[model samples]
Target: MDASNPGEAPETDETLPPDDPVVAPKARSIRPLVMIWRQALKYPAQVALALVALSITAAATLAIPAYFKVLIDRGFSRGGDIEGINHAVELLFGVVVVLGIGTALRFYFVSWLGERVVADIREKVQENLLRLAPGFYEENSPKEISSRMTSDTTLIEQVVGTTVSVALRNTLMAIGGTAYLFYLVPQLTMWMVLVIPAVVIPITVFGRRLRNVSRTSQDRVADIGAMVTEVLGAMKIVQAFNQESRERARFNAAVEDSFNTARRRIMIRAAMTALVIMVVFGAIVLLLWRGAVGVASGEISGGTIAAVVLTAGLVAGSFGALTEVYGDLLRGAGAASRLAELLHEEPAIAPPARPEALPVPPRGSLSFRNVSFRYPTRLESPALRDFTLEVQPGETVAIVGPSGAGKSTIFQLVERFYDPQAGTIRLDGVPLTSADPAEIRKRIAFVPQEGVLFSANARDNLRYGNWEATDDEIWEAARAANAERFLSELPDGLDTFLGENGTQLSGGQRQRVAIARALLRKAPILLLDEATSALDAESERLVQDALERLMADRTTLVIAHRLATVRAADRIVVMDEGRIVEQGSHGVLASAGGLYARLAELQFGATEAA
Candidate 1:
């Protein structure tokens, strides 16, 4: 199948890291966090409430230090006045009560926003993923994509729920406390101001390094997740090959790599924290020493000294907290940027702005004209070379070819999964590209080599082909596909849960179920990809009978590997090296002694070829 345009470059090659899954682009800034901010803004009422509560809590926190100053000066230091002390104690209690209430509200609203925003983002990303063409998955790993959906979004949730709130609250405290410190003592405030530049410079330097490490750390973590999914999904193969030890070593290596990357990130964050703390609190100590001297000289009261000490501590602590939260914000930005890549991806195959409609009362005729194509991954060789064929309505044409001879490519083009680079394909006389893909596919039904079923009940799997099919209609189709007997014998009948990929059913039963699904589709055109190729003789006969019934009155295209399967086909087209070498009825092709005759001798013995 032509998975992508031969000339157009893949979208992932430009946006994603090259070759190495563990490598990631450096996070230059926190600007990518704006996407998260937009998602949070969707609930304005929650935002307003959270902000209001945060402000109230910050104000109340500052008020406590001021109240301490009042209590010391007017109550304890003023000849121990009982009434003044009682009044001060009561007011401090009131402030504490308000702070508790405000903090609770802030936590509630912010966490709600975090959960809601992540949920919405998941929905949007999955929706866009569904719209993307198969070409995207061919280029990118679904396992890596799954990690982004889980691990990356979790980082975003932490940022919204905890890091953002902590950063904002500390900012308010730092600014307000600084102003109050200045009011209390200009001399000390000026000294701390000089130390601010020292603290900020280290934060800026260490933070940049941290951002890069954090992004790489996330990539390594995603690599680990992808590796785990790959290994677990193929556990049976590993056990059969006796390669369990090798798989274990590979998983251990991935875990160690993830750990090493994370260690670098945390080390940078730790250094930033220690440096900012030493610079900020060292200045606070000097200020306190100066304040102590003033108290001894009677230049300032004891209460004034106490208030300066408390407020200065608050300001220094806020600066220290900012350094820690800054690291988390950068990590969140890295995650948001990765997710944004998927959310913003444009589908390479989409309906035209004004798509032409297919003709009603479907004629079911299909045609391919001078079609030449190559898969994007294999640009050196063509899958179909100048392929041209025409099928009349209600005719069954069987295609016979060796592996890589473009037999399946014909089905892919017919369904418009991809457009050929060099030719045009039409259905019912209308070009495939000119009409909406969904409308064109509605007229065709496909039954693949393996019967693909979802992890759902039998009824749901049957209805996947046509959701509106009634129970009576479903039973009728089941009978036509030779599936009614086993279905009726099932424990819950149609309601029975079919295991993943329908592992609960036998090979023949699964193929019959697939035929029943196509029967329910009720499309005028049917495409079968050797549905009974892997079945035993008895099973093959049953599936073949079911397929024959399904093909009656429908335009059918079948890829046949067994000579017996195509003997009844209206015409057999023999393909070799992506081109048709011969075309005729079974008897005529046998008499020609060409590629079909060769294939017949190999499958049906030399006597049958004659």
Candidate 2:
């Protein structure tokens, strides 16, 4: 459990359940908030400055009642001495000035720490997320993760910037004011102390309910975020299918669910606040009643009675503020626990310590020996079974198979996205697992069926394949890939902003740009997943020309469904049900009266007749 204040308990175990995808297992205590404290400690200077300011302001606030006591006893009681009254008033004003200055400084430093800490946390979480394997994403929603990065971090910011500061300042005031109350009238102070348990019991009981509801509330909000992202990203599909009403209904339910959860959370907090306030102030009213009796009997002086009332009120208000602070801390703990999960997630696919370096002067030879694999999400059916093949340097092998025949799986394995369950895959004779995944990828260039482009200008997107490529070298590759014509016609040439996923370019133009990117890579191995499958006849001809130039001196693996596209390849491999059933040239396969022959007959017959 987290100590009520920053420096209370030793650090507790931070381990959480490994498989909490929605919300972290409900935090039973604010121990998760200790993570935020550790992060804040990185800047000790700022923390020290903020603490100094907080202490000064707290002391100044408590000094106000003491000054009031003096103003009453020394100034007003002495036949209204104007000079003494003015002097006491000036001292009170000075304290007020000190309080104001300290508060401003405190705000500046704590807010700076909050923003800085959240920024560092975001960078750290994203850095770890980038290192995780794709399988992790398969198990977690990107939308929910995005919510964690934003919504959850905002809550952490509140804790660091506002809630924690409030907590510390109020605790100080409560302790100081209570001590002064004892000095004024110990009997009254004793009675108030007895009521402390009344206030504490409710906070402890209501706090548990609030913490559980807070976690559920955060999960509900994440669900709404995921829903909005999903619906907006698929708006076209929704309208085309005329399902807007259904989507709206679904979104409404999600929003309502979120609101309902939040309502439950606030209700619990409201009840806690009301109960604490009533108990605390009720105790203060009773103490003041007793103090009035003492004042009447001439036992307690007027100034003393006045100071006791003021100090007791300050103490009561501080205790009351604590209920809200405790709730905010619980909420912050929930947020911190979620982010900690992301920050501490170990990448399932990390580079091995002391990884073996690939051989120099890459030969581009790829060999998959009896590789059998299944996707993490679909383990019951293997995507590749005993998939054995070898492509020598400078060889172009086209892979043809029906959907789910493992053509794409071969590319995935080559990229080392997932390791095979059985058998070895090697690039140049080095087992892929032995070398670093980055080194393996640096030697291979891949162009998917749809050209994947970032939301960047043409120069950046083209240079993505080789960041060090010169402009002249980029143009040369662009010309070879037949992209120079349209690229030169682009409004700002290569500097033009290619909208999200290169939506600014036509299908054929994007494919050419992708080919130019691959050409710029100049890697020894190329993987093309039917680059021309989605283009029209003219576009296909242009992309085919570009692909031919790209394949000139590289060992290429092409996954093609259009039989006409792979006719001139050095060899063709036909797969079915995760196994290669046939391997031969297009001519040989056509004459063999096999699966490829039938597919070729259907596509070729249609093309020739057209």
Per-candidate TM-scores read 0.93, 0.94
lDDT of 1 by residue, 517-564 (tens): 988999999998997775678767876887786687899999988778
State the lDDT of candidate 2 residue by residue for 189-266, as single tens digits.
898899888889988899988887787678777777777887887888989999999988988997887799889999
In model 2, which regions exceed 4 Å deviation? 1-26, 606-610
Q: List the residue pairs that clash in candidate 2.
A: none
Clashes of 2: 0
The clash count of every prediction, one per candidate, is 0, 0
Give candidate 2's root-mean-square deviation (CA, Å). 4.8
